[model samples]
Target: MEIRHFRYFLAVAKHRNFSRAAAQLGIAPPTLTRQIQDMESDLGTRLFLRLQREVSLTDAGRALQAEAELTVRQFEAAQLNAQRAGRGETGHIELGYVASAVFSGVLQKQVSSFRLRYPDIGFTISENLMPVLPGLIEEGRLDVGYIRSPMHLPEALSTISLLVEGFALALPGSSWLCRLKEINAAHLQNEIFILPEQISGTLQVAAQGGYAPTLGPQPGGLVAVVALVSLGQGVAVVPESMVDHIKLPNVVYRRIQDCQPSSFLSLVYRRFEKAPAVARFIEHVKDFSERPTL
Candidate 1:
């Protein structure tokens, strides 16, 4: 009837003697005998035949024994799986990122290292614009996020700076900005600064460098912004890491000289998270950030 009944049946079947079976079960022989009798009464079938010195299994007893063994094994396996999931050893983790995170290469390296360490954990990654990533994390659409700074983070979200990098101007290959060896805010005074439709961290960087840059059309994302820059539509300042993502031959990235404003790559997650996997991932990111980099 209950799992204990199956256990009693198995112990008796294994030992064959009531006294020995009860001893293995840490119970008295009389207790074991009564339990077996109760199980048989509940099942409406005799499970064992009592011989002169030992007990032998009847046909029904053998069948029930086989089924009980499998059932117990499966139940134990289920319990173990639940525990592992609770411990964050096995579960799904969704990670969202801005384009700069990928360009920085830290996000990819951190993910690879985490996967190697926690192979049982499942992961999914999404590349989103800076403005949406924090909301995605807060709304539970993403477990964690990576984004560039000048972020207006909600109270529910927490962040850690992974790296600090300077901004670089993405220029048209034939533009005069590319010809200047050392660029300053003065050089960009008359330039049209292409900005993404979403939140622009570069605006803060430009502000810090004392430039009231002329605004260009707001494109969809950094990729499109750079594409527009390649067409000589305008120039754009982005984190240095993002230059790696700019593959357009028509665009050249130049570092700002004299007064370049720096930007930070930060990892963001929800506060008071209940998922152990999310906590583990946050810890991994922190640890990765602490290590020395060349």
Candidate 2:
């Protein structure tokens, strides 16, 4: 009839004596007997054969015993899973990121470390262009995202800067500018700019050089943009870390001199994300961002 009734019935069945079972359950023997009697009445079947001072199970009782044990175990397991979810130790998160985040290696390091710390927490990550990432977070399709700074974020979303970096000039290896020790903004005045669709920092730096440079079609990321540059399409200014992941034999990275453009990554998420797992991940990232060498 109820969970307590099943428990009482099992206790009586285990000890084979109402008095001993009641003592084990910390309840009065009469109370235990009444509860069992109520269960038998609800099921419309006699569960036990009561002798002078002993009890034995009936055929129906044996069947109920097996089902009851499994049910109780399953119920306990469900409770434990719920508790784990509440603590943010077990759940799912959908993370979105720009391709440049991988270039820095900090994103991968933080994710791997978080996995080691919270193995039960599950998540999937997707690489998206900066323009689409904020929309994904706002629409609830993505729990969080990493994007370039100075985005026109939605009112419902918030962001935190992960790291600040400087820009590097990506040029064709055969280009004459590669011969320079450090490139100054003045040097880029005559160069064609191969820009990623979301590269506002690069655009700004190029503008400061007094060049209303010709803009190429929006290449998706630094990798693609660099590939275009390697073809002698145009020069690209990208995050300094892009050199780490997009190393091409025909492409060379040069530090920007005289005019150092600010480059940084930011984490974006809904201001009121309901998932405990997302909160845990955000907190973990905050701790990672505060590290000295990140």
Candidate 3:
């Protein structure tokens, strides 16, 4: 039966007077009577017994009334939630970040802006490399990953360039690289370089000077890299995000000149089947960025 039929029957049953119910519904008396008649006919039962302008609900009307009220309430609730989701209000976002974001503030700012706009959406963050993250995102275990560029994005994956931050030579406070106001590629040729194990682009860039320096690929994690450099184990090329953290007590950071390759950063998401909330969050980020202000 039509929803209006339920509304009409309930109003008439509640008022117990055809004229009063018709007026309350802002419908003509004859029209209200026809609607009630139609509902009773459709249900194959007498919903109301009319007598001298007074009405009383039949057995079926009472039974249907209880269920109809619940249906209407549930419908209203569903509509409210849909609206909230559309406005990017209620949902959850699983985000992944590589080591660079840990030092650079760009990722944090993007997330902060998104949270401010969509406060109801919870944030779940993961810090990992693309070799592992790509599979997780494709499997729906992750919503998005902040990964380094030069990725082999499959057809099942999509991405938007987030930032292209150049690598700087990060060193110990007393190291000689820190003393150079401007670092030339040749300066790094003889120093031990600490780069992430999964970063091919970083290795390629540092190789431009053809240093063939000692390979200090610290596979453990960012902390290990910093610790190694602080103790003068070797020099590594790190992104700016690492600087955002409290500087490693004895570590120094400086930009490199005549670098072979640039550092490219991107937000990676599974293509074609991303959750709706993920798209909404990305759009908010793009909008806020173009607003001409930080």
Error of 3 at 41 (Å): 9.7
Which scores better on lDDT, 2 or 3? 2
TM-score of 2: 0.92
lDDT agreement of model 3 with the native: 0.76
**Tens digits of lDDT, candidate 1, 1-294:** 787888889999998999998998899899989999999898999999999999999999999888999988888899899998898888889999888788888899999999999899998998887778889889999999888876699999989899888777788989887777788777777888888633354565467567766888878678899889989898887777777767897998887776666778899998888998888888989999999878
Clashes of each: 0, 0, 4
Which segments of model 1 are wrong by more than 4 Å?
196-201
lDDT by residue (80-119, candidate 3, tens digit) is 9898887667889888888776566668888888888777
Regions more than 4 Å wrong, model 3: 1-5, 19-51, 56-68, 82-89, 174-182, 197-201, 257-261, 289-294
Q: Over all chains combined, what TM-score does candidate 3 have?
A: 0.76
Q: Give candidate 3's error at residue 13 in angstroms.
A: 3.5
- How many residue pairs clash in model 3? 4
lDDT winner: 2
lDDT agreement with native, every candidate: 0.84, 0.86, 0.76
- Cα lDDT of candidate 2 equals 0.86
